[model samples]
Structures are given as C-alpha cells and as structure tokens.
Target: MISMHKIFRRLIVFSILLQLLIACPLQAFAESEEAIFAGGCFWCLEHDLEKLDGVVSAESGYSGGDLINPTYQDHSGHQEVVKVVFDSDIISYKDLLKQYWVNIDPFDNNGQFCDRGYSYKPVIFTSNQEQKRDAKESQETISVGLNIPLEQLKVDIVESKVFWLAENYHQDFAVKNPLKYNFYRSSCGRDNRLKKVWGEYKY
Candidate 1:
C-alpha cells in the first residue's frame, strides 16, 4: 500500500547509503601501504613492528629467494621477513624505517643476535623506487646520527621479491607462544645487542 513517491524516496536513501559504504572502504584501501623488512627472527620482527601505532598488520614471511612454497626447515636463500601493512595517513614510511634501525644491529652482516646464516640477515626490501629512496635516506640519517660510516650499515636495501607467507604455526608466534618466545628472545642476546648498538634509543 506504499505510495510511489515514498517508494522512490526509500530507493534514493538506500542508494546513497550503499554508495557511502562502498566509498569508505575504497578510501581506506587507497590510504593503506605496505613495506617489508628482514631483521633476523621473523617472530621478533613481526611482534615488534605490529606494535607501531599506524601499522595494520605485520605478517611473517620469506622473501629474496626463488624457492616456491618455502617451509621453515628448508627455506634456502630466503630471509625471514615481515610484511608490514600500515595506514599512510597515520604514519609515514620514514618513521617506520627509523623504528627498524633501532630494533636491529646494522653492523652484524653475518646474522642477527643468536640467529645465524642467510635467513637471518638484516634487509630492507623496497617494493618501489620511492621506498628504495626513502630507505637509503633513512640509512644515511641513522649513520650521521650515530656517527657511523655509511659503509658500516650492513642492512641491505634491495628490491622486494615475491613474499611467501610463512606457515600457520609461525604466524603471530609471540602471541601464540609468549613464554617460549620470551625465553628464546631473552636467551638470544637480542636486547643486549640492540642496547649496545642503539644506546637507549626508543623505537
């Protein structure tokens, strides 16, 4: 028994509501950006980066390798990396890079903390020219601030390769296995090394 006028008004209202809903998500998606980094242990890096204010998620993964479907035990040539998705409106990529330097030892080319070999090497994986430029600039800023030579900064800034998501059990490892992760992190001399390298710098 609804009049045509009322029905047309209802349709108009519904159309406006649908447009708003669709536009909101598209706007958010446009503001979202991603950056990848490898600072030794994926569990520790993932845990650390996710704590940043604007970061949406930090996912553990493997990158800079050719292996397809790499696994924890057999990811040869792959580095343990964390893919960080962040809201660009809330935080800048430069800020994230600053945090990254404090969390890692740039002098250690072999590996990070107790973790060794190729998989643990520190790296900044850039997805585009802008990221690469930002990373280099950040590295230079850190070197000057720390009074260290640029050549001494061992963290490689390279173009990002295909990022293979780690196994389900490896995701959110610190959250899932806090006690064990804590014990391992403590025993690995990570904090001590970071303190020596960064000298009370808060990340």
Candidate 2:
C-alpha cells in the first residue's frame, strides 16, 4: 500500500497538471501552417491576408532576392511579400490560393497597380512539393477559368527561400497608418484594377 506521503505527492502532481491544463488551453498550442505570397505592396497584402478567417498573423517581408537582410529602401531585387500563419483546421491551402489570386493582378508581368518594379510583381513561394503542386494547379485553374492561355498568366510559382522580415513599422502599415495607407492604395488604383480584372468580386 502507498504511504500517506506518497499519496500527498501524487495529489500535488495532479494539481500542478490541472493548473497547467487550465492555464494553457489546447487551442493555444494548436499546430499552425504557413504560406508566403509576394504581391505588390507588402502593407496591403499583409492587411488583406490577415483579415481571413483562419489567418492568425500576417507579417510583411521581402523574398526571392539576392540581398541579405533586405530593407524597404534597400530591397532592390526583393519582392514585397507577406508571410501568412494560419490554422489548417480552419482553412486549407487551396482556400488560401483561391483568396490569393483574387487579390492581385494575375496578368501583369511588369508590376502591380501603380507600383512599378521587379519587386512589385506577384509570386507564390511554395515551401514543399505539395505546396508547389497546389500552387501550379491553382494557377492553371485560374488560367482555364478565365479562358486565358496558361502562358499568358504572369504569376510564377517558385520554391521558397529566405524571408527577411521588414522593419516593425512596415509590418502593419495599413492599420498603423490608415489614412496614409488608404490614400496610397487609392492613388495606386489597386482596387480599381482588381475590380476590372476580377469583375464585381471582392477578395
């Protein structure tokens, strides 16, 4: 038979475990997935993607560039990108792709809206083979659905590389600087072109 001291120790352990379970909910530790998208203006992309149901966080960054630790002013070849962290149980990767396409100008090879540069072109950076396959399929579906040739679509699917997070101020520019963000976005004609390309549908 166990001694009284042993029973007391077990009870203590159980109490500690109960406290841990209560303090940290299971959903707090739920597994999360990540997707990277390079669209024009990381501020706009971050704001749009984070508004999605399953998206837990969206961080503005730069990717697909030769520079190391690229900054907003220094990211010459880097594309303005957003890293989306989401819960897979709430939204699938396919759903993310579907939403991503509607947010940008899929046909513009030059740049997006008023942003003119290599850094402004949209891209999907896949983290794995499955992601690459899904991205390609999504691109194909868009091409076929629009009755446009696959070759004509400007969006490219590239394997993901290092993602350098932009400065903290740039992370949530839309929310932090709403007036300026709105002015810039409106003057850039981003929404107008998106409506023209996507036709009455909001992403």
Candidate 3:
C-alpha cells in the first residue's frame, strides 16, 4: 500500500506524462516547413507564393551559389530565390510544385523574364529525398502534359543548399511597393508569357 504523499507524487508524475503525450505531437504538427524556389525576380515569387492558402511566409533570398553570406550587391553566382515556409498539414508539397510550375516558364534556361543571368534561373530546391522525388514526379507530369521530353524541361530539381536571406527591403517588395512591383512585373512581361505558356490553366 502506498502512503498518501507517494500517491499524490505519482499522480503528479502521471499528469506530467499525460501532458507531454498530448502536447508533443501537437507542437510537432504546428511546426511549419520550408521550400526554396528560384523563379525570376524574388519579389514576384514572394508575392505570388504568399497568396497561397497554406503558405505561412515567403522570404526573398539567394541560394544555389558559391558565395558565403551573399548580399544583393555582390550575389553574382547566387540565384534569386524565395524561401517559402508553409503548413504541410494545410497543403501538400506536390500542390506547391504544381503552383511553382504554372508561375514560371520552365523552358528558359538562361534566366526568367527580364532578369537575364544564372542568378534568375528557375529552380526547385528540395531539402529531402521525399521532396526531390515529388519534384521529379511533378516535373515529369508537366513534361508529359506539354508533350515535351524530360530533358527539355529546363527547371532544375537540385538538393537544397545554404539559403542566404536577402536584405529587408527585398523581403516583401511586392507588398511594400505595389506600384513599382506592378510596373516591374508588367514591364518584365511575366504575366503575358505565363498566360501564353500555361493558357487556361494558368494560376
């Protein structure tokens, strides 16, 4: 038989254990995930991806480059990428892949739109094997839909590298500078080309 104090102590420990069991998985489920993509201007990508339902945040950044601690001024080798943090429970990674496909021209290898350089090249950076597999599957599906060979699809499905966040001003340039963002996006011919390439299926 246990003493009252020992019984009370055991009850307390059991309560703590119960709390951990209930809270741990909920905390894990609440955690968001990051997906990196380089599709022309980071500003536009940030703007477009954030509009999606499950996206928690879209931050402009530089990745797939050799530079260490790169900045907007000296990021020559880096591609302008957007680091999107999203809720996996709310949206599937495969759907995000589809959204990425419609938003940019996969055929262009030089760069996307008015931005002409390796830095603006469209890419999908996968952080894990599952992501890589899904990205490739999405790529293949798009290739089949367009009747283009897999090699013809210029968009890359590379393993994610170090992502250097861009300057504060560059983060949400679209939301902050609506007029300029619209002007730049329009002048760059992003929307028109997207409509032409994606047709009625444009996102």
Candidate with maximal TM-score: 2
Most lDDT-accurate candidate: 1
Return the TM-score for candidate 3, rounded to 2 decimals.
0.85
User: Model 2 — which ten-residue stretch has the worst lDDT?
Assistant: 194-203
Per-residue lDDT tens digits for candidate 2, residues 88-175, read 9998999999989998999886889999889999999999999999999998888878878999889989999899999999978999
lDDT of 2 at 125: 97
Clashes of each: 0, 0, 0
Tell me the lDDT of candidate 2. Answer: 0.91
Model 3 residue 170 lDDT score: 94
Q: Kindly report which residue stretches of model 3 are placed more than 4 angstroms away from their true locations once superposed.
A: 1-29
TM-score of each: 0.89, 0.91, 0.85
Over 111-181, each residue of candidate 1 has an lDDT whose tens digit, in order, gives 99999999999999999999999999998888888888999999999999999999999999999999999
Q: Which residue pairs collide, candidate 1?
A: none
**Whole-model lDDT, candidate 3?**
0.90
